[model samples]
Target chain A: MYQLLNHQRKEKLRSPFWTKNILMNILLGFLGLYLIVTALVVSFMAAGFIREEFEGRDVIEVFTAFLFYFFIFDLGFRFLLQQLPALSLQPYLTLPVRKSKLIHYPLLRSISSFFNILPVILVLPFFIMIVCANQTGLYSTIWIATVFSVIITNNFLNFILKKYFVKRPVLILAIFLVAGCLLYFDSIGNAPLSGYFAAAVNAIANLPFLFMIPLIIAALTYYFAYHLLRKNFYPEDSQTTRSRPESYSFLNKYGELGELIGIELKMILRNKRPMSVLIFSILFLAYGFILYDDPDNHFNLMLGGFIMTAAFAVNYGQFLFSWEGSYFDSFMVNRVSSFNYIKTKYILIAFSGFMTFVITLPYAFISYRIGFVNAAMLLFNIGISSVLLLLFSTRNSTSIVLEKSQFLNYQGTGAMQFLMIIPLLGIPLITYIVFLILGIQQYAVFALGAVGFVGIIFYRPLLQIVVNSFVKRKYVMSSNFRKK
Target chain B: MIELNNLKKVYGTKTALSVGQIIIPERDFTGLVGNNGAGKTTMLSLILDLIRPHSGAVTSKGKIVPETDEWKNYTGSYLNEGFLIPFLTPFEFLAFIGSLHGKNSSDVKDFLNKNRDFYTENIDSSKYIRELSAGNKNKIGILAAMLPEPEILILDEPFSNLDPRSQSWLKMKLKSLHLEGVTILISSHDLKHVTEICTRIILLEEGIIIKDTKTSPDTLVELESYFSVQV
Candidate 1:
């Protein structure tokens, strides 16, 4: 166990991504610090915010009523972001280590997940502010313990949920449906689930020994995960059922370019990580509802337009070449031209932007301003952002494992992805702000569209530039990819 | 033909591979045999331009492999599973490779039919390449390499995971390809298969070619004695 723990530390420290790139490490460290500080501030302010929103009500009771909502949201958050703790067990499978120890290593190591830490950061402060001040020491202590027990229970429950959900994706929709039904029922006053939930939690404080119920629940969840993991410890045993081969012969008309796009589409659809990224991007289309409802916030509207249109390009194109890192050698040795390879990526990202823009056209029914802004942003994204993203992608040498979950999997991210986002999103917003300052804000949208129009006209030459960069960096990227 | 001129690859202070002036002529069936760290794979990677050497160059058919991609048109090689796309099924992967070589689906079907002996039943299944067994994956890779019918063919450890029958079938298939005037370069730890199928054998030790000779009946015995003495 000690050796396993030590190996885990070395595994992280020796990750070529971190060890070779000190700048990336520092950037990631700062980003992590920023997130923790933000969460802490939010938690500190949460009690007062709740009190203000629900005036004339008992603050403790109100907060306690919402604890059930918080746990459900935490579960969903973890389901999306938390990675199954992996130790590359293939090598260890053949070693002399005990099977139980091997299984326990990852399970125990998962307790240290940022998902686990986040709840503590976002809940502990509120609990201290509200429960500690209003109740006796013993009561508050047991109350906090009950909440933490559920939190730890959530950590284990997520493992089982993710494992099963991967095998049966319908379970994901079912879970959402169940949660939605609960919310609906609670809102219509058909069932006072939140009130009962708060009473149960209050009971733990009133009778401190009842905290054992949550503790036992946490223990049971841990045992369930252990049992499931032990049963399918071998790699082969955990293999999902084979996917049927889907035909894309309709794409044959465009010849090589269409074939390439078909393969790329299949890659995104079939793989876990890329598919999740696509779904996440599609979800951003709803941003218009939030931003467009308020007419005065034109800047927010532009931001929303940019996000909705370029979400796929920014998210997926950030790791453009890295997507094929697994089969990079085949590409090098095969007869596929680097120019065409890059052009295919450009076409896909641009098409995604167009498709998103069309889907969001319905927003124009609400207001024509929403339509004009999204249209300009869409053109900018497909023209400028797409080309710029593909150009910057040539500098990305980190190889992403497409099979892994995307939530916190920072496998292929580098300084280039982060730096590129500044200009890709910033240029349009900066152009808008400049126009607003010049007192000609209405024409700013057209100016942005004109710039993108020029980019669209010269796309062939721009793509050539990206291809040149890719050809120059091919050897470096290939070598880095082979490291894994 | 492929030519290696003063090829040298260095990993830190150690010279992983260094070869000077070796020409692999057309239709020459060359086998590279060596110990674990003998730099066999490294040399192949350099020949394919998968890695850039510290000094010197590899030229295929008069064009430098790194400077021009013309060589990729007539060269087919599979160094490892990295050459196979995991999400693609066997048929899709073969078709993709064929398309790169300007072959349509009909052409791919023809190629599959021609190599029916080596094409296993698993290739017809709908499973992705990642789901297939190691031997089946190796077969798909080998078949894809040969699908384009290039002048040059290269494989690394092609016989490792294959069963005995499949191994012999591949040996026969490779021998037939050599007979059809395809230049072949393969590295294998199995001395018997290499000696039987390859017309020439090159023995590498510690980044240097210690022996280069035409393979005769006694070549396997010589290799066995050399390896046993080292052990």
Candidate 2:
């Protein structure tokens, strides 16, 4: 299994897409290192704050009391970021290898996962500086063992949770609802749960044998994952049943472009990657509250407006062409005109932006200016940002696998996708800044709106250019989409 | 009729296909037979306008395919799995294709009923194309192409992933469709199947057509011997 996994990794690294952009990799590497360092500094500072907060109380006990919250974040992060272990395990399924070994390969490979490294980075510095320096060898050992146990339990727990999510998504929602109820009782209903949790963590140091509890939890989680993988190893079991017609047929009434938009909507809602992006965009709509809470943070208001309205454009439009990469050839040979095809995409993004602006309308109560600024930004996003996104999207010929994890999984992203950020976010901001420096601060909003309005006015001619580009690149796009 | 006038396609340094002055007469059931990378798929792609030829053009009914949308009104094609939309149900996919050619859901349902044997258990089951078996997915692709009642149908390697029963069913369907005077082009590596169903056979070798002949009773034997010697 190790040999097979190593061979897979080597082959993946050798793929042209992976090695094509050296600059992106280096930038990503530096960004990762910077984040890790920032996390370490933040954790150390948090440790110091804990020391100051509890002057007489045992720092370890106080830390243990807060461990519950840490695990909450850990579990949530693990669920989102952890890559499923068996993505490349399909080829090995038909081989003579044991099923148990095949399943264990991904589980074991996950031990070295970045999810595991992150918690250790946040926890280790404090453990060494505070727990080790202040406690006996036995106390430190038990404390350290407790942390590792929770981390391991969280890891395997994710495996079980994700297995359930794949098999039955409702189970995950039910589990979360139950967890929410428990939190309510502990924090607001004066239940014994919080006391019990702190007791459990502190007992690890007071009674070293209590460390066995977490280990048992980890083992049980691992066992559950093993059974789940064993039961669902075959290809037949993996292909989920479609159950019923989840597509919306009502949109068919709007004629061909409407039907095309309906198909795009179904693609977003049914697929894993696009669905996640849709959910994330909805979640981002609440950012207006965060940014508009303070009037002094007006820059955040403008940025939020731009990002919020163009949320789908930034997230989904980056891979606009690649999203349909699998079936791009069918589009080429079909009777659909390039003009209507590109126009459907335009309506999808612009409609989403318009909807976001409407959703963020209640933020107007903060001040009328806030509402005006956001409206201008929304217009700019729909008119200018979406056009830029579509134009840049034409250059993207990379075929994206819709099944892959969307979080931090940069598969189809190229240098062109990276450059898409320039026009989407950078150009508007630069325009605003230049307008502000010109001493007509109030005109900045109107300037951005004017640019976007100009785009909207010339929508026909602009759409023609985009349509021509798409038609011109059909062959190039088709060939690129065909590549693995 | 479809005409390829000096159609040439190159991928970087390699010339994938370079066919000159080939006219596929209307109502001809032409089979494209070639080894892997022999430009069978590439040629089909060019004819369908899925990829552009570096030089020359493909004209269908006196209009260039890329310049005019008129060819799309009469053409139906399925080159491979790349042409299948995996997110959609088989019914939805076929219905979508039918809608493109001005057929409604009832028309699509009637079309499915006509070729029900090709799909067997898969047609009634509500499963996404991605969840279905490879053979079933291929069935969806072929059915989608046939659903439009097109005048020109192009299929590449239709028998590659199909079960024996499905393969035979498709052969019968193709023969029936051919009898209805629909111009059909098929590419396959299986010489026996090609010779059995196709009225005309074109053998491609190294991106160029080597043999273009009308099929006879001895065509299968001739193709077998030719491949055996080439190997």
Candidate 3:
């Protein structure tokens, strides 16, 4: 298995002229360094949670809540990026590979996944903080519990995920939604369960047989995941059964562009992967409203939500190049108007921007009663923000070539992404800060409108210029997007 | 008719295609042949104007090729599933493509009814493209491209992800389409099938056109050489 993985990596790096792909590699390398630095900062923070006084606060509660949500995020991304693509192997049964062995190797290789280490990295610090701050004697039993914590947690995460993918994706998503509400109510947000786990940790550290409990749970979770694995080993049998009627065939409600958007939206709704991103977008949009009790922070709330729209568009739009994945050759040879192709993406982002505003609009209007002015402001901001985003997106699309969504690869790591951030939020943030500096509290609404007005005036011509540049830069864009 | 004038494209520090001037004969079913890095894809991309030529120009019909959308009315293609919207069913996808060519929704449905066997898998008719396999996804893409019934059709690796029986069925369908005067250009590594179907075959090597053989009984030996991949 190790050899096989090594071979795969070598092959990935084998393009002879990839030596010229150095700029991309350096960008990827910097992103790696950033993640490591972030990890260290988190570890230091977790170490502080070791203090005894921290226990009385919501430290453990917050930790568990975030950890559980992280587990959901992990599970959602895994089902999409990893398990979803592995599904293609089902049609390859006639290619002479042993089905059981092929499934076994992928599953076995899955155990060493890159993501499994993140929770452990993030969680261990809090446990350590709980230990060292109390100055508890380094009892071997307490140490044993930590090891059990890793196993039981990892096993449960895997089992929940494996079981989810085994079913139809939508049904799995439904199960996830129901489970989330229950978990929030029954555990994380519930004082009893949080206290139980916290106190259980303290008692377990105090008891002689406390080590045995986690071991038992760990064993059971492991067994459950393994059993699920065996059942899914023969995916070919499930292929024909996985069929469903075409649910997204709405002839109305779309232009050629709009229909494309509708169909794309439907896939996102039905699949757990893209749906997770959308769900988070909705939550954050609403939560922006809920974040402050102070009425004055409303402006900040709108700005924060607007900022998030820029971020989501950039992150989501990166996939457009790869969305075509392997079919790029067809796009290359077909009679698709490059102008229309680029316009479709612009329209998609614009639609998302609209959605972001519409979702947050109710929150803004009901609370502020700013009325039609606010609605118009939102529409304008959305248009400007989406246009700016696509402008940045066009540049990024040129540089970042997406392959099939890799299982563990989250960030695509291009200098253009870095470049996007500087403009995506920076200009707006600077403008907002300047507004504050200018004693402009009364003019915040007018200022946002002014920005929107400017975006409207120049965005189309800017878009035309950008699309023309995109045509001229197609070589650069295609090659860059296609790079390692 | 499509004309290529010294059409060529090269990536930074490496050449991918350098096809000297050549014209695709009017109404010919042509097959493209090459190795993994051969210029087959690059040549096709140039013709469609998806990418600009590093050097030359391509013209379709009497116009200067795709300088306008005029040729699109006469062209339809399926390069792969990426050209497809995953959330759309085969029926919906076909309908949308048909509308692009100014057909009614019923016209699109009529096309699918005649070609339903093209999507005969038991997979959910109601599900989205994200739910389909690569092969099944390809099937929808092929259906969408053909529904428009354009004068020119282009396909890349069309027979991939298909069972042998399905492959035989598709070949027969292509034969009929060709008989009806649809000019087809296919890029594939499947030599035997290409030889059996195409009236012309262009062999590319290392981004250079080494052979542009029109299919005739006398060219059987050249076809054999390509089948065996002997330069």
Candidate 4:
């Protein structure tokens, strides 16, 4: 087991994904630390906030009532973000290690996931501040133990759910249905399901012996995962099913560039990683609902419009050439010209931005300001931001494995993507803010549109610049991509 | 015609390929033979403009490959599986490759039909290129390279992963293409096949060309004796 763990450590350390770019690793590390600190701060503040919000109710009761909702959210978050612990166990299978130990290796390794730590950070400070401050040490200890066990249970259950039910829509639909019903009942204020959960947790806190219930539940979930995995432990059983071949013959009429774009669209739809990015972009279309609720905040309105229209372009375009890294050699050697290649990517990304803009145009009904801002941002995203993203992508040489899940898979990420965030968001926000300072915020929005219109006019020259950069870097990009 | 002028490539401290000059004339069947790490792939990569040389250039028809995209119009090369898009099926991959060279789907279909004996399975099946066996993948890659009826064809170890029957079929196909005046450049470890088909052979050792000669009846014996000494 120790040897297996050591091998895993070496595997991670030696993976070219991390060893290639120490800067990206450092950036990710800082981002992770920032999130942890933010979670801790939120946890500490929650106690006082709960007391103030529910003035007449018991503080512990309000906190415990919300615990159920938090757990559901945690489960959903894990479903989206938590990567299943996979080790290259075929070699170990032939070795002297026991089969159970081999199974336990991955399961045990999963406990160290950041998802497991996040809940503890979120709950620890709040629990200590509220429950421990008022109650006896024994009572608070039991309460904390119960919450920790629930968290562990959630961690293990998430593995099972993701392993077996992720591809099956029925289980996911059932979970969503139950969550929706609970939320609906709670909103209507009739026998709220959260009230019962809070009462149950309070009862368990008062009775220290009942802490064993959550502990047992956690143990059962772990054992259940173990048994399921042990039953179907062969590596062949874990292979992803082959995707059906798709034809885009209709795109032929649009010429070679259309076919290229069709190929990219197929790549995104058929691959797991790019599909996840597409899903996230679609979800970001709802940004107006959150940011536009406060109609007067023009800064957020501009930010929201930019994000909503350019979500796909920004998320998917950052790793534009990297997506085709696998076949870049073939692409280069073939009759495809670098200029046409760049144009294909530009058209695809900008077209996606245009589609998103039209889809989100209904946000105008909320307010004419929103409509105007979205229109301006849409032009900016397609004309300026998309061009900038394509330019920056030439510097990214990291190759991405399309088959892997996008969640926490940083295969194609480089420092360029992190640096790109500043200019991608900064330009619009800064331009809007400068206009607001001059006391003509409306014209500032109009100015954003004007800049984008100018960019659109000179898009041919901008595309040529991108193509030139790609041409100069093609050898390096092709050689780097060929490494894996 | 392809010309390499003082072409050199280095990886870290080791020079992977260095050639003062080697001009491959039009309609010539040229073979590159070497051991592992002898830089056969590197030389081909430089010629394809797939890798930038240290301080030299490859010019086809007096046009620098890196400086211009004209060579790609008539040149087709596949060095490895990196040339194959794994997500697309063999037919789709061929069609895409064909489309790039102004060939329509029917043209691609005709090419596949002509090479029907080379494929052991259904070429138009839904199986993605990645899911195919190594030999089938190689076949798809080779077929895609030839689909454009390119004037210049470059392949690295085209016979390595092929089955025995497919290998002979490919040999015949190459001979036919050579007869039709298509310029062929291939690198292989199989001396028997290389000597049998190639009119000219270049032996590389440690990034330097050791022998460049036209194939005669005794050339196979001479090459075999040379390799036997390395043991």
lDDT of 2 at B27: 98
Model 3 agreement with the true structure over A326-355: per-residue lDDT tens digits: 334444444456666666777777667666
lDDT (Cα, tens digit) per residue for candidate 3, span B1-231: 888888778788789988667877767998988889887877776776667777878889868764576877788777645576554565666665775667777777667668767777643256556567787887777777677777888888888897787788789988999999999999878877888888998888889988888787656577566557445
Candidate 1: segments with Cα more than 4 A from true spot: A1-55, A85-114, A121-133, A136-142, A167-196, A203-227, B11-13, B53-56, B113-116, B119-121, B217-231
Candidate 2's DockQ: 0.71
Interface DockQ of each model: 0.70, 0.71, 0.37, 0.69
True contacts kept of each: 0.86, 0.75, 0.45, 0.79
Worst 10 residues of 1 chain B by lDDT: B117-126
Docking class of 1: medium
If scored against the real structure, what TM-score would every candidate get? Answer: 0.88, 0.91, 0.74, 0.92
Q: Which of the two, 1 or 2, has more lDDT?
A: 1
Candidate 4 chain A: 10-residue stretch with minimal lDDT: A165-174
Candidate 4 residue spans exceeding 4 A from truth: A35-49, A124-145, A164-191, A203-220, A227-232, A240-243, B229-231
Full-model lDDT, candidate 2: 0.81
Per-residue accuracy of model 2 over A246-296 as CA lDDT, tens digit each: 767778887778778878887887788887677667666766766777765
Task: Estimate, for each residue in A1-484, the C-alpha lDDT of model 1 and write its tens digit.
Answer: 8888988888878877676677767876897788789878977887788778988987777777787887888898888887777787888988899999998888999998787887788778887777888889998898888888988999999998988786555667577768868987986889989888888988888997788999999999999999889988899887766657788889988888888899999999889889888866876676677778785577777787787788888889999989988988888999888878888999999899888888888888887787888888888787788888988888887777988776656777767877988988788778888989998877776887888888899999999999888888999999988978
- Which residue window of length 10 is worst by lDDT in model 1 chain A? A166-175
Docking quality class, candidate 4: medium
